[model samples]
Target: MTDVENVAEDVSLEGFNPFDPATQQCPHQYYAKMRETTPVFQVPGTDIYMVTRHDLVVPILRDTATFSSNFSTAGMSPDKELVEKMKEIMAEGWPPVPTMLTIDPPHHTRFRGTVATYFTPKTMATLREPVTEIVNRLIDELPADGEVFDAVTQLNVPVPIEAIATVLNVPVDMMADFKRWSDDFIAPIGSNPSDERRLEALRGTVEFQHYFAEQLERRRVEPIGDLMSDLVQSRIEADPGDAEKGLDVDDEGKRELTMSEMLSIVSQLLVAGNETTTKALTEGVRLLAEHPDTWAKLRADPAGYAPTVVEEVLRLSTPTQGMFRVVTADTEIDGVPVPKGARLVVMFAAANRDPEVFPDPDAFDPDREGLMKKHLAFGKGIHFCLGAPLSRLEMTIVFEQLGRRLESITLADDNEFMYFPSFMLRGLTGLNVSITRAA
Candidate 1:
């Protein structure tokens, strides 16, 4: 048996499955135990390793050279059947392309650099009025008092989709379609998805590819002031060329983004920008309802405390739970030997709650001291979320509007929080709340 296999035999995983429904609803208890006993554990039935401790996770994320994010399935069983199946399904979609999120350095830098300026704090700040407007408008459409509604459906999902759609320059009416496509695209990627689900995701991928390819063509012809136009028209020098040399001096030295490249990045933004923010908003509202004091404090001073509440919400209920990194070479994580090419799962959610980092880790304390942006909700290192500023803006504006508009809100007794059938994505499938208007 391999060293990893030997190590797995001695460790007691205790039936931990992040994809299980029970675990999704409440994984912190499991995370705490894993942190205590097996910080760098080999998952029982798989060759994948789970890095449960904060200290170990940070180094893995920071040192991308050693731990590559080329793709989650890098070190998977190289069975021909599975390989052929993946290719057959993926062929239905856009041609194979790599975005900033799924690639390592050099290539990652080039892709991310193409549009990083658009996501900068300064650039994102310019959209405050629009974001706030979108929030107020959604709140305006809320049900009258005595009528309850699902927060995830009415508020949480719509708000972020609309905001991101505007950035993508897509029609607001298409937000519903965007949500549907987003769900379908990510469904197959969830933990142990069945063949049927993979086909469904395949359909979504093909449809999305065709739709966005047309958008790229249009933007290339007539440049617009939106992100799509900016991306397609972006020109950066090729590797062998220096900035001192003209970007367009030679074909080898420079290139505009290809159709596949454009599709990859824009589609990535739609998926990443929509799902996590939607989940975060759902949990933020639920957390407030669970802890009335936090809600009361936010309603009392929306401006002063909304930011802190967002941070606390992010820490307590991180939307994207963890990410997989493939080990480039044989390495030791917190002293555990992880063989070369071994895939490691960085438990960002677990790290966020590490006792070493935050006191009373599991407690939802917005007022906790030293709470000045110290969480891995947006991840760390070079791959840190680019749309974080926009997400924060959306949530802050959302909470501020909720405070001003709703007199009171409480989760319905029958409301059983169901998470998406995903090990990576942490979010409520439903969140019904009884709300009152501020009359």
Candidate 2:
């Protein structure tokens, strides 16, 4: 289909609105227009600058010194009252502080180093069997032949949280509570930002702080063989530079992370571990269901072809569409000058389909040549997603088993698929599908 023909009959390129029903249902046409014209353009009604083209986005992702990952620069309130309440929870421990997600180096370098070893490909490789088991357990719960279900709630949402809860050594009984916390934690800043949403997010943050503070205390007394225990016992060896700053340390001169400090790391993991992957899995299923040809190819050789399928789904679906970066100094993107302290919205979804980089960018082709060229789905540079390996693992395993079990799958209705309203996230609200089991 030609670019203009791809757009819904009523929606015009000049009138594009991401939140609009037509655009959300089909965003590729709009992204294509943005790439073809204003690669570095401002949103129609917002000051946020969007970097659409692959060339423009790669530079922003790479130039960490000029573009920071800190979201605080976006000018959201810190909520002083919440800080005061958390002080009691933190006590001698440091209160929730900047984590790898929100901090820029050299502090980002120091903080990421604390947990980087645990996320390496080698460490993540151990999760294959457990993740597969989780996928199978969820699949077993599916109804007997010719039944329908909301895949998002039944599978996509719960499976990832189970994997995350297991990793954190959080009890199975607390799965519901963890899901609640995860929902409330990230809800505040999605598509429709509001006071009510902010309040909900704060409540979740406080509740999470209390629960994890207790967990850290338990791990201190009894070092369980889990990620949480490793974090509780780990300490930062005081450097000579620390002595210059007159910081206190133990006899060995190493400082352990405080309860609140550990909370920051744990919370980021809890949210990152589940949320994006859940959405990605949902979209992956939708993609396969919509394109039977691709589905057939994947099922034929899941073990060999599943990885490539996962990459294509990630590129097209792009769980986290974009993230805010603070410009440190004056810079020009595609020759358009941007001032210092400006908030640049780096659009990963836009770049993933850039025609220059991916031939036939609009189509979903897992066999597309040069498939190994890294896509920004997990991002790039030092701030690249630590959970990328685990996310890919979860999607691949879920589909690998799914391809084997299902003879066919298709959407249950003709209604437009609904998406979560968020400035940064791209996900389905529900995906009802009919399944036909294999004999």
Candidate 3:
């Protein structure tokens, strides 16, 4: 404890397992407790420090130099033998996936740049028509009596995944396989007694790698007019004569985007970019249902679109529950010394709802003109999400169309609002609503 004032009330580790299933399914109460009782706390036996407050957390994520983005695997202690056995079963399908979720600095910047060019707001706008077409076609199928449908399973989930896959030139028929693999990766599987569920995700990952490899190889020969092709063709090659500058590459005539680099790009986008946005729409629709007045206001305006919905939805339910960082060098965070290499997790989900930051934090008010109206759904600074523009574009188009087309909507079932069970992501599982005629 490097000579700090006692402004923060000391918090006990007590019996909090942030990753526990119960905590994940419904983290609002847990987040509220963390916000009030102990904003900054350390879990017992785990070296990870949990920063729960919005104010304290904002700077931690923004100042990446002091706090690192690395994590320790001291907590996930599943039987190794089981992981191995499943690996063997899922052989050839378990190729390692190198994603940007677990990285820092220079390399992160370089990789983000290559993919970012394709998803810039301008570039993303080109996608609106096609995406809207897809949405309309999907909605057109909705019955006139305002038939009940699981928003997640039917429209919200498929839209982005399909859009991304289409852009990548992945076969439409393969969307099912892609979706199944995504589920295996993100959906919780705690009962895997032998970490077999994780093994399955591993298998899916490996298969994904193999698929990308083949796709890259195909792009090498038959160049498709798409982002994937652009990536494979991208060359951050050696700045010639600067012997120390160039990165080693194979015979593929490429540099920077090694197999690892590609894995990092594709895996993160497919998983993080996919699930986060998808979960967001699910949350958005559910919130609108819960708050009919808000829904009615939007349905009338139509222009409020997905942009307004996205902002309000993110404010209401942050998709990224927490972002982890590690202290690289001796630096002070919130005026407290964080020893070198200490892992810190900035809880943005909790922070977004901070009463100090947003008045009536619990309530949904889209038009609340906060100066930082953007929110941290995509984070801030250099490490900000690359796919954000595309995400916003897609979601906005989806919601605007839904808002305009959705005449009447009601709950399909009274099943409790289901949320993705995890510390990192938050969204309802199945937001089934029958839509037509009524606002």
Candidate 4:
């Protein structure tokens, strides 16, 4: 079939509103249409451009000079009333600043360097034992055989929260609060949240800032050799010599992170550290239950199949659906004109399913060879996820444990899969499944 004939008849981009919750639920149809017809699409009546194709997204991610990561420069402001109210609440805490995801190049380089050593493979290797212990403990608390339970709550949620807590040297007892604060931090992203929801999110943000600010202070006075202690003591060196090379490293001089900067980075780690993994884990369970044949293979050799399963889950689920990038100057993508200050929503989820990149992209094939590393799920270029090692460790352990402990897995009778309403994130609100223990 020709490319035009290959397109689905029902797929129409007319009045496409990605922010709509319905569109957020099952966007594959629209994504396919975008990839085929208009790889670079502008949302109707908005300055936002959606970059859907895999080929197009990589260059945008690499060209930090043209497509900036500093979203504050995008000039997109929130509701005036909501902004005013949030300001009042946020004023009580340390002011928010762009630390990791929001800044580009030299600023990003220095900020990421401070905490980069903590998430290195060598560091993650030391965490395997403790993380495995946490996984087994959570698995031990699962419901009896043939009982229905929410995998998200029982397993997916706690595994990462507790693992990150262990890494940060915080009390695992406060995991419930940690999860809540993480949710609150990303509450307003990718949606037109109600005034009430926005205010609530602001209050929760202040609460988180206050709570972590104390922990950061404690680390300063009493160095405990934890991640927080490292953050408190880490310093960046001045490199004026590199400025002429377009490195932008000399502006801030040599310094430790400001209290506000530390809080911002910690908030990101708390949210990114757990939220993405939780979504991916929940989706993995759902996929295994839906595709029992794949689960059966995993059951046969849990450890052997786990690494691929992790990659497949990350690709298919793509917890972070897309991210915003502000255009630094007027540019054209694939011959289409894009104006300066226009925001680009680089669709990682859509790009993962680009048929050109992954043959039969929709299939849940764990054994799919060679393409595992090609998915942009962990992202591309300089802003690639820092917590990838830890996430992979947690997920690999969970799948292995699930395969070893469960004889059968299936969706609950009344279960209706529902994702959280956000364009930039894709995660099931809950996943209810009935399972039989391995004999």
lDDT of each: 0.80, 0.77, 0.68, 0.87
Better of 1 and 2 by TM-score: 1
Residue by residue across 136-203, what tens digits does model 4's lDDT show?
98888888877889999999999999999988789999999999999888887887677787788888
TM-score against truth, every candidate: 0.91, 0.89, 0.87, 0.94
Worst 10 residues of 1 by lDDT: 1-10
Off by over 4 Å in 3: 1-13, 72-75, 86-99, 144-146, 187-194, 237-256, 330-332, 335-338, 371-374
Count steric clashes of candidate 3.
17
Candidate 2 segments whose C-alpha is farther than 4 A from its true place? 1-27, 44-46, 73-95, 237-247, 250-254
Full candidate order by lDDT, most accurate first? 4, 1, 2, 3
Candidate 1: segments with Cα more than 4 A from true spot:
1-12, 72-89, 239-252
Residue 402 in model 1: lDDT: 84
Encode model 2's per-residue lDDT on 137-247: one tens digit a residue.
Answer: 988898766677889889998888998887787886787788788777677443544555655666667888889889888988998867878887777766576656555
Error of 1 at 286 (Å): 0.6
What's the distance in Å from true for residue 436, model 1? 1.1
Better of 1 and 3 by TM-score: 1
Residue-pair clashes per candidate, as listed?
0, 2, 17, 0
